[model samples]
Target: MMSRVAGLFRPKEAPVVEQEILSEKTAADKEANVISHSQNDNSSPSADKSPDTKWETEEILSDVQAGIQDVEALAKVWTRWSLIVAYITIWFIYFVDAMQQGMSTTLTPYVTSAFKSHSLTAATSIFSNLIGGLFKLPLAKVLDIWGRPQGFTAMMVCLTIGLAMMAACNNVETYAAGQVFYWVGYNGISYTISVFIADTSALKNRALMLAFAASPYIITVWISGPLADAFYHGPGFRWGFGSFAIITPAICTPLLALFYFNYRKARQMGLIPERKSDRTFLQSLKHYVIEFDAVGLLLITGGLALFLLPFSLYAQQPLGWKSPMLIAFFVVGGLLIMAFAGYEKFVAPKTFIPYELLMDRTVLGACVLAGVLFVSFYIWDSYFSSFLQVVNGLDITKSSYIMNIYSLGSCFWSIIVGVLIRTTGRFKWLALYFGVPVTILGVGLMAHFRQPDVNIGYIVMCQIFIAVAGGTLVICEQMAVMAATTHQYIAVVLAIESMFSNVGGAIGSTVAAAIWNGVFPKKLADHLPVELQGNVTSIVASLETQLSYPLGSATRVAIQKAYGDAQRIMIIASTVIQVLSIISVVAWRDIKVKDFKQVKGLVV
Candidate 1:
């Protein structure tokens, strides 16, 4: 019985050991199973695990959605007032340009009368302006580096001084020098502003801005022409020109202030990231100077100077085509121009112009088209007032009012075309489909213009037609050119186009003047009776002298026929050039418009 009791006590210890072993075994088994399950889950696909794993991707998608919404909201905040300000700034600058440009028409007669030479007027107007054109490329580079405000401010100051000089000048030399300063100052500042506007505006809205920019030239014509005439005759003639000294500074102050404020805003908003330059200021200046093509500048400027000098001098003194100086200017100037072309092509390290643009097919085409259009523009503008005064016997103010009709047609149609371009993403097809034929028809109609014999209503209609057609063509041309190149090359392309257009204008003016001079005098002498011929010549010599032709009679008939013939010939010739321009338009390479990225602090 004692042995049995001891066994039972030992058995209790064994039971306890068995219980502990079972628990330990279970714990080990559970840990192994968890590890194995985790490996399998990681290796294989499963629905329950996916949501937890994709959380990061879902978060990214939400962020992107929010970003897009923010962008859209920001775009909505960009108001029309910004664009309005830009338009007004451009208008102010171009209005000044108009005063200078039209000042020539009024000033020319006074200049010639003062100098006692008819040729001096043409020489001073054309050559001094050409010198200004020559300065444009360098000024553009300066604008790019120093920014528009400083460049424009400096130029305006120079221009104001130039005008003051012109107003006070007592001699022809001082007057001519003043013209040079005026041209250099005006062209450098105003032309750069045009480029600056191009840089700022989106492609879609550029035409509208440009139209507004071009508007002041037209709008000012209505006011300035009459104002110039009125003032030239008025007691305040000297004061009228001098007043610009004060007015220019007043106009510039607001623009400069805005420029500074905009620049500060751009910095705060991080619009353009700052670039670090290794060179010192002096080094940078040296680099810019060394890189500028001095030889190209010299040849090009000299060529223009030589070529224009004779043309400007021709109408004033020793009025013969075959004068030794004239022959030398034509020959030497032509040779120098060819040399400049060669230098630009083969030798220059930093070209004054981008010569490769000349070789590019699309750029070349646009240039030709712009040249023809501008040629027509200058011809009508330069001669039209004289035409109205002499042939129509209308006063300057009335003729200017009539010219407003042309401006109205242009302004209206250009806005329409700009809207069309923005909507369509197309340029040439519309012009080809609607514009070319219309322009030709307009030119043809204008060619038939005569004196009182031609219907005044028809003449006005013709002006409207030319303006509409020409406006559309120019807008299309601008769009095509802008589309062809990137921002880096736009300025040089513009400069080249301007250079060629100036050449075209010079040639057209010279040729037209020559033809008119030949036809008018000979016809006046031949048609009138022997007794009346001397009187007619005397009146021709003194264009200011009051001379009346019989109403609806033989002498008036002959004069009208002569005027009609001269105008028709010039118009027909201009039309033929324009037809060639249309052919040039066919070669433009097409570009798809891309939307501009919204810059954070852009004013417009």
Candidate 2:
């Protein structure tokens, strides 16, 4: 209670008020005070209204007012530089973060191959992100109490060590352990950085800062493939992951030191308040952890694991859907989720995620739309390479180039959509108006794809269209989700969405991969001779060696025919996924713009 009273006197932390504007408001207040003082003096003139006393008070007031103006001028200078400094700092940190994520993709195929694993080992990537997402909530609370710079710096240190450990690993256990460390650190730091940007930036520049921060994600996704290839194929893959450990510290350390100095400087200037609270760390833990709904977290996590595990293990040689272990995983996971909703309704204080949010039209709609968009992205990213390989007859490097095209499309659209949303507040209609048709057209076109030679130009166009539509939905969802809730909950909401996206990607990849691999082989057999039908993998290996031959001639017609049929089947599955995404958008509620205001007990 005393802490709450202290906040009433604490100065607001933000961009300093302009000196001229400050002077005008102060002078107006002084004029009123002077008039009141004069009236009081007249009422009690006999008490003594000496000239010297009046002059002394006036001089003191003048000194204080001039001192305030000087302080204001200095504050303005710091504010401008702080924005620039922060942008550069976040940019550098985020660059390496994205680079690491991108580098992982290149490492996965090699890592699995080295270990002699039959599966794609993409689940390692999912598990890494899963660990990261799980840590985001705890990290969010930590940032609120410890301050952003300190929180960010601590997480970065873990990240650096984690990367170093992974680079030195020679076995799968050590490698997985190293991955856990890297992910835990990466998720915490990235999440805290996001909150810091939201807290420190102004309304005008918030979207721009967010867009710049997110740039590294797609940029690295595009660049990491070639960069990793260059390093891994030449020096070693270990060196590839190790490169991040060295480079990241160089990028992060200077920014962290600068942020610390600036934060201190701001606090002293009365731009940021010294937020001391009565509650102990133990109290905070109890309040957030013990008070939160554990059942909900368990249910959601279980549901996601059940839905994703099948895909993670699908492509393995000894795949089995009817095994006792698989049945146990699904049955128990399903029951736990069903019980989660019942717990939510009966539990007191509820979970960290309120049931109310699930019912909120805008918030719920955004989640559904996000799931669809995520599914599309999963299929595009996971299957596009296979498509290029089978239909376009491209090698790993060439197929990667085609996949990078989507990242380029995403990058350009992210910035464009950010600017558009900020300029036009009609974000709801912007999504529904644009999302519905482009999604339908793009997914519909993908369903009908055939051999690259038939119309390669058209295929690329359709992919780009889907990319734009998906990008638009991503930006709109960010706005809607943030706008729908209090700023204090924004970090939690984003983390939830991030978790869902991970789940969606896992499910989409599994389902799409299953469809393509399951149906395409049968289709391939229909046109090819019975002897050649069963040897699909060998046929593709043979086709690669025969790339110079006329793609349309009878000599390679069988291969082309097989590839075309497979491509069509995958596209058909994608269309069905896209339609489900559209249906999910129907539940989304429109959210309104809100200003940043302090919420008691929740300083974030």
Candidate 3:
């Protein structure tokens, strides 16, 4: 076995005719030539060789081929069982994610009440968004360098720590810190899973696998809200978060073990190349510093955080847009962002994002589409449940049920689109031609029908339509981006795509906050009777009190109308954003999903 393994790397010998020619030379010359040829052969093997060497080479090649065939057979068997395990793990992750989202949505009012601050919910959301965006690039680099198992382990550790912190928190600040950690972990894990799925599945099955992985969200959407509501009303909201902290690691252990096992097998089989570094400790530190591009991460994260900070702050601040701090944040953040662009373009030895990806029409279009669609969705969604409670007068459970129709539609259509893509091996035009128009129509209807007197059925229909469009776009855009790039860059590119989407959500939520804060209070004061004007601040601060006014009373009607007007503006903004998304879809090239070929390349 040892001899056969060594033989695989042994050089072939010269042909018989070449040996005869060498025999014709002077004995001393032939000896010198043989020495020179052996030296050359050590550096570069020759294809032309002697009969004995040829036989030896063939035997070694045959042995290596047989080994490869055996490894392939073992790999197939492992992949079949492991993929099932992986899918199960992904489903649990999605379920937990959905539960978190549901709890966050339903428990916002309670959390804010606990903090005795109206702005706490929005503040936490902005902070979470920042964390999610900030950590994605670093996580991408970690996955690239350390491989998936380590990356996944790191993410799980962060998540567990974050959840524990949240469960133990007594103050809003601590809770906010917990959220930061949780979101960072969540974003890392989510992005890693996407790349993992891409790595494990074939191109033909990737869409279906991703869609199937997401199916848990659909089920969780219905159950999580009620579960959270039960927690809120029974054992308390802390338990809602605490239970998951313990449950997540338990569910994730097997998945992590599977990843470790597969990695070990692959490494042993020589399928994975070993990374060699001979630098000193300090030198190694510097090498990694440049490799991870830490400065680029700081600049972009700081820039984005600063730029987006003011948008959320302006509405909450006493001075509003006139605040000096807001202006400074905006200006400095803008400059840092520009500096980051310049650094990437000319200064960085290795760029954090490859310029080639930016130039790819499909990738660019997918990012824009995802960004714009998120902006559109969030514009209306940021304050949607509040509207349902205040204006529509629905209870927490009912409003949650109504809101989750969107998730239901999203999950259902995502699966359908995935199957269609798998069957037809096409997605770009489906998103462009069908998804864009449907999304436009949904947002348009939402804008037109957001009045207080609008039928609940119409609202539900609009949610379903928008959700379906969102689902279609999500699957298609992901497929387009993945298909356009080689596997090496997939994780980072996906991170970049996620960054755009999260940034869009932050901006949209901020904009919605600005619009709502700017318009709602003034509208409420204007519409309310003179006697009730003094209480506008208190009323707007607490949505519960806003809904406490007697049904069918003049005050109730005025408050409802005010909410309707504000929501209409938000819906219109969403409509405009969706229209922009539709226009951007024109840039997407119709890359065939089936034709995607994984190329060998270094991670940038």
**Winning model by lDDT:** 3
Cα displacement (Å) at residue 230, model 1 = 2.3
In candidate 2, which residue pairs get closer than 3 Å at backbone N, Cα or C atoms, i.e. clash?
13-271, 293-351, 361-589, 362-589, 365-588
Model 3 ranges with Cα > 4 A deviation: 1-77, 170-173, 270-276, 597-604
The per-residue C-alpha lDDT of model 2 at residue 520 equals 47
Candidate 3 lDDT, tens digit per residue, 395-482? 7788888888878888888989987887798897779878899988988898777778878888888888888988898988888788
Better of 2 and 3 by TM-score: 3
Compared to the true structure, candidate 1 yields what TM-score?
0.76
Per residue, candidate 1 scores C-alpha lDDT tens digits across 162-273 of 7887888776777778777887777666666666656555565566656766766556767766786777778445666677767766776766676666565545644334
Clash tally for model 2? 5
lDDT of model number 2:
0.57
For model 2, state the Cα shift of residue 278 in Å: 9.3
Residue 101 lDDT in candidate 3: 66
Q: What would the per-residue lDDT of candidate 2 be over residues 393-416, giving only the tens digit for each residue? A: 665556565566555666567677
User: How are the candidates ranked when ordered by lDDT, highest leading?
Assistant: 3, 1, 2
TM-score of each: 0.76, 0.72, 0.83
